[model samples]
Target chain A: MNDTSTRAPATRRGKGLLPLALGMVLGALAMLVGLAEAGRLKPREPQTVVALGQLLDAEHRRVDLMLERGDMAGAIEALEALREQPWPDHEAGGDVGMQLRHDVYGRLLRLRLDHPEVLPVEPQALLRIAEEGLGESYRELDINPFTARLAALRGEVLEQLDRDDDALAAYVEALDMNSALLDRELAEEGAK
Target chain B: MGAGALLGLSACTAKAPLTAPAGGVDESAAGGDRDDASLRAADLSSLELELDRSWEELRTLEDSREPASVEAGAAGPGDVVDRCERIRGLADRICVLSDRVCALADEHPGEERYTSACGRGRDTCTQATEAADRCAAG
Candidate 1:
């Protein structure tokens, strides 16, 4: 009876210690997780940076070659094909995808504007293309000449549509972006 | 080598043989100063033609590399140091040719024809530069 009674406390004590130690370990883990997620550390994007360079290169060249051969319709068709490509979102595809879309759309618009007879797209249709190309999230992407170009082309399309007020506004937006880019480039050059 | 080093080396790509200065008149063949001047003009025209031809060759090469690069491979992977070396070489050739055209236009002042040639040369340079930059960035 004495041995049983003595060992009972020790067994209870051991059981108590196991839960306490496990709780301490779990509590420590939760604290570390909370600290890490408090915005001190930048959360990496869920997707890796998209590398669409080779894809863009080939598409760009294919269009260039078509233009070089004086095949305006062919060039326009090729660009339309590019537009149909399965593009990932900004988070998934990164800024390059956005930049490339801008470039592709800009060229398509420019060609349609320059050779309207080739593609025979109406001004209203062209405006839709421009608006669609500059998606809702475009403003959030990094400022780049391709984006600026798409913006400028949007202005041109607006002008053709006779929305002079809207055209001016678009031009102003593009100009502001371009001037900032120029200033940064000049600063970099000066520093160099 | 590094991409930067490849770009640098490409910048020094050998000048086209046709880019040889058209100076030093062959008085023996011309037999007169006016004729020598005419010969120089001929030489300039010939150089411009050759430069245009060379530029086209480089452009064609650049075009040929485009078909399967995005779909298949750039002949293979491009994660290595010398990845865009071929692109740099093509761009360099076109760049040098365009520069020669610009120089020729500059040397002979007051020629309206050269003004147009210079404009085209500038366009070619811009295209080549953009291509090189895009390729290297990849």
Candidate 2:
């Protein structure tokens, strides 16, 4: 009877330890999860990605103004500055910066196509840059209708380079993909 | 005391932090309200139509000459620059209107600041459309 009473307290102590261990593990897990959530909620850096997009748009307007004023040299200089701007490789919101970079490239190519004298690089080189930009845009979005317009633009560039056969092939491919590509502008205009 | 401490810990973990990802210029920051967004989008659409018509006029004046394989032979240099200036004017107006709307969206709707910004945008867009019409007529 004396041994039974002594062992009873020890049995109660062992049962008590299980709840304490479980409590500690749960507390640790809660702390870790809270910290992770805080990290995820941290605000994105301000005036880095969004501001850069605004700056690019402003510069494009400036270049257009220079062109309108018949200041070809000034336009070229502005375009060079635009090319030098460091566009972000990626952003959390839909890769906006990368898309803007492609748009800047498109503007430069259009300017060169309109006035070859204003371009610092050869027409062929500008065309190649445009082709690469459009190709990447098409692949990334997987929008087939848009590719038809891009391919038509590519055909124009190929013709500029005196590659008649290739230009014809691109035109054919664009048509085969969608005849409506020719009326793309009409659709936009009608929407207005 | 131990039980009280455990209760406090549980209470702290029960409430989670807000999950809104901050800093990017989202719709709320770009247009303020649904009404504002639809109005601005309509304004933008009108401007786009005007721009297309201007381009068509300019192309016609150029005798359908392609952008490539050409060097100022489409029309006189002066005419080309004049047409370009009109287009640039319209484009600048768009930039101004958009920037103002975005800035106004950052402020509360009840504030006078929002009213003034929207007013300016409407005025500018109206003037731009008139100018574009004149350009197309010429």
Candidate 3:
């Protein structure tokens, strides 16, 4: 009887080992599958921040050329096209690209207003979309020049809207900011 | 020990059967929900485009003068005061356009599209009008 009991316990132990081994293998496979599914196992794709910046910079130059030629319609159309393109990941350029693009769009809209004979529409609606895309980045980033320009452009738009007091205030604000910016640049030059 | 092992295996197997059904139900519930972000983005984009076009039109009118008047001025056919009146008319048109743009901007404040565009169209329109007024006064 004692022998039988001992042999029975051994048999049970041997049976438990198979299931335990199976469970371990199954658990490991599950872990690996979970990791893969979670994207933890995948290699991260590199973002092309520099390339995107270059592209945006080139676009800005083209838009600028259009503005210089007083081609307000062309500038507006080009900027609309530019805004349609996916913005670079904010992490890649730290919101600077976003701010630049936002400011550029704002400038284009203002130029449209400045030379309405060409564009014929204010583009305030389009600018609002672009601005929303720009979000807090405009406020957070050190994009004073771009913001100032936007403010100036906005002031022009306000003037077009006939809110004289508001327009004057906006222009004055822009002028003050621009003056301050110029002073800062002069001070930096002096320091240098 | 064998009994304990058997019990654990049975419990796991029982739980496993319940998991698949519960997972399916959860997935169906999630899938049935609407995606608000996509809808909002679309609405904002469309509205932004509309406002932009309007603003652009206002700007264009501000920049151009009646070619006939300019030619008349160069020919010096009209009285100086009359020519100034004509110039004032052009300026008034610009101011009217500016006011219209500002009205549109005001109509859509805090709208997803307008808010993103700069939330300052009204301010911009106001400024443009004032400038036009100044030009007109001159």
Looking at model 1 chain B, which ten-residue stretch has the lowest summed lDDT? B2-11
**Structure candidate 2, residue pairs in collision:** none
Off by over 4 Å in 1: A1-51, B1-138
- Model 3, A60-137: lDDT tens digits are 556545545656577678766866776654444343344445554665565555456764654565346434544554
The C-alpha TM-scores of every prediction are 0.45, 0.37, 0.38
| Overall local distance difference test of candidate 3 | 0.40
Per-residue lDDT of candidate 3, residues B1-138 (tens digit)? 011011111122222211212222321233423253532333233323322332222222212222233323332211123323323433343344344434445666655543433334344444544543554576
Q: Can you write out model 2's per-residue Cα lDDT over A68-174, one digit (the tens) per residue?
A: 56776776677667766665443221233344455556555556666676646765886676676554434443223334444545656776776655655554444
By TM-score rank, best first, the candidates go 1, 3, 2
Q: Which is the better candidate, 1 or 2, if ranked by TM-score?
A: 1
Here, model 2's chain A TM-score works out at 0.52
Question: What RMSD does each model have against the real structure?
Answer: 27.8, 25.8, 28.0
Which 10 residues in a row give candidate 2 chain A its minimum summed lDDT? A1-10
Give lDDT tens digits, candidate 1, residues A77-172.
988887777665665544544555666677788778878899697789888778777777788766665576678678777767766556655655
Q: Model 3, A76: alpha-carbon shift in Å?
A: 2.7
lDDT of candidate 1 over B1-138, digit per residue (tens): 111111111111121111222233332334333443454454444334333332223222322323233234343212232324544544454454455445555655777665665576566556656755765676
User: How many angstroms is residue B100 displaced in model 2 relative to the true structure, after the best TM-score fit?
Assistant: 42
